[model samples]
Target: MLGKKKPLIRGESAWHKGWKDLFPESYREVSFPDKLLGDLHRADIFTSCGTTLEFQNSPICLDELRSREAFYPKLVWVLNGKKFKGFKILKHLPDVDDPRLDPYDFCLGEHLSVYRRAELHSGAARPLNFYHPELRNIPFTSYYYSFCWKQPHRVWYEATCPIIVDLGGHFLYQLKQRPQLGESYPYLHMITKKAFVSQYL
Candidate 1:
């Protein structure tokens, strides 16, 4: 009993473990005991800046989502975008436009909160091809893109904190939801993984 092995946390995946490994050992799996709730909440990575990164790979109920947000005031959800099979990222907002759509609808893209006639691909294998070999090269800068998720987990929309998505690429996307006419619109900010990790370190 003195040298017992600890069991892996329930629902922990290799992707979760890999993200945790990037941080210092002390910052990983830091738990806070709450007297009022009579339960402990362990953050995947509690940064020195007092931000808790919660890596969510599965669908979470509204109750649990609100509870965690309340528990960790400075929380940022690091969602596993790969979990959603129907997630698709379209081209940058600037290059995409359809003559069929009205000005307002065209600007919003093919999103749930709005309707548009642009025939975006159901499934996109890569991020927007902003670069072309024939064209002169310019340093790449991060840009926001409109996305279409088949059945997105809307629970995250109610969250007060920031939500960063891991799309398994050279970059991590920060999901920003803007409220327009009492509806939530989704957009992704393309950021380099190195830049994101550096802030925590």
Candidate 2:
């Protein structure tokens, strides 16, 4: 819907440019007035469905994260997971009932803590039966995958909006987490890139 091609902004990374190129110019760099702050907020991509997609390449603190969420209520984060050297995507859901997985060796809210199961069993267990008191709340039916990230930015755990990571594969993984007994259990939900793009287009 754009009449003319807009000039590229300074220091815009190729990662951002690549994703923006997939959409029409009108949807890329769409701006909205922040009446509460008397300023304008520009979104990376604003789709026909009114969902604002923010392409994040670097780490951001909790304050900025909250501010962006507040400014754009219907927001979805498309993060560049390749930049994170510590981030590792393990095989699909591990067996929580496996005795090798020591329930006592986990730290509250740490993603790496639970990934120990992946190292121990590596998706060898069957049926996905979870008997441990700490694992009771998790929804096993979801397309959840175990992951381990060394010292992942804690701010992401605070994100209230949907977040999907681009790890340079055929699919984008949605980061799903739930707080139980003051502890955090984070996992990944895989969706093909074709499916993700088709939905917005």
Candidate 3:
């Protein structure tokens, strides 16, 4: 079993503090050695329950994020501490047969994920667009959602099951509405907070 883990305190950043406060049992700033995962990588927040949470505030290339999400048993939860963007909980399963070690092939691999057919975890027929001056030349990019594209350095993005979520306020609470169960393949869908409260509350 993993030992008692604590988050690295560079300073009291509110986002970090929020997660640490909410899930005190999770280990913070975790690193997986080379090839143990696909590559040497670090997770901001991880739990023994088989999920890893990635936090985003700055602009990062989507390809990089997509590659990273596949390494977990259930890398659920894209958490945003800021109120502008809410949080999303993804239903994830690694494409690899085993997670404790890399595939014996020791080369690159593709991932497969699916969603709850009822929605909140389904696929998007449209390609979600995102804009950054840096993104102008990038192919297949048509950044959507003007509300989230307010300005640079203030937005966050998470691609769940291939659906893009530009979260808004009360993100943690948004996750309480569990999405419907579906097949396991890569896709992203979101559930309504109201649906969750009515069903589980």
Off by over 4 Å in 1: 1-10, 94-142
Error at 36, model 2, angstroms = 2.0
Worst 10 residues of 3 by lDDT: 100-109
TM-score of each: 0.73, 0.73, 0.39
Where in model 2 is the C-alpha error above 4 Å?
Answer: 1-8, 94-142
Error of 1 at 36 (Å): 1.1
Instruction: Give the lDDT ranking, best first.
Output: 2, 1, 3
| Winner by lDDT | 2
Count the clashes in each prediction.
Answer: 0, 0, 19
The residue pairs in collision within model 1 are none
How does residue 141 of candidate 2 score in lDDT? 38
Q: What would the per-residue lDDT of candidate 1 be over residues 95-170, giving only the tens digit for each residue?
A: 2222321322223446322322232333322222223342113232337677887787888777788888998988
Can you tell me which runs of candidate 3 are displaced by over 4 Å?
1-8, 36-39, 77-158, 161-201
- Candidate 2 is scored at a TM of 0.73
Q: Write the per-residue lDDT of candidate 3 for residues 1-201, one digit (tens) a residue.
A: 998755556654555555445554446667876675457777766666545666554455767666766665556444342433332232232222233212112111121222222333344422212232322233331211112112323212344432223354432222221222322222223444344223312
lDDT of each: 0.71, 0.74, 0.39
Model 2: per-residue lDDT, tens digit, 1-201?
858855567877788788888888789889889888899989999999999999998989988999999888699999999898688876455433345544423333323334333433454422233455555554453455778888687788889999999998788999986443335567788899889988888
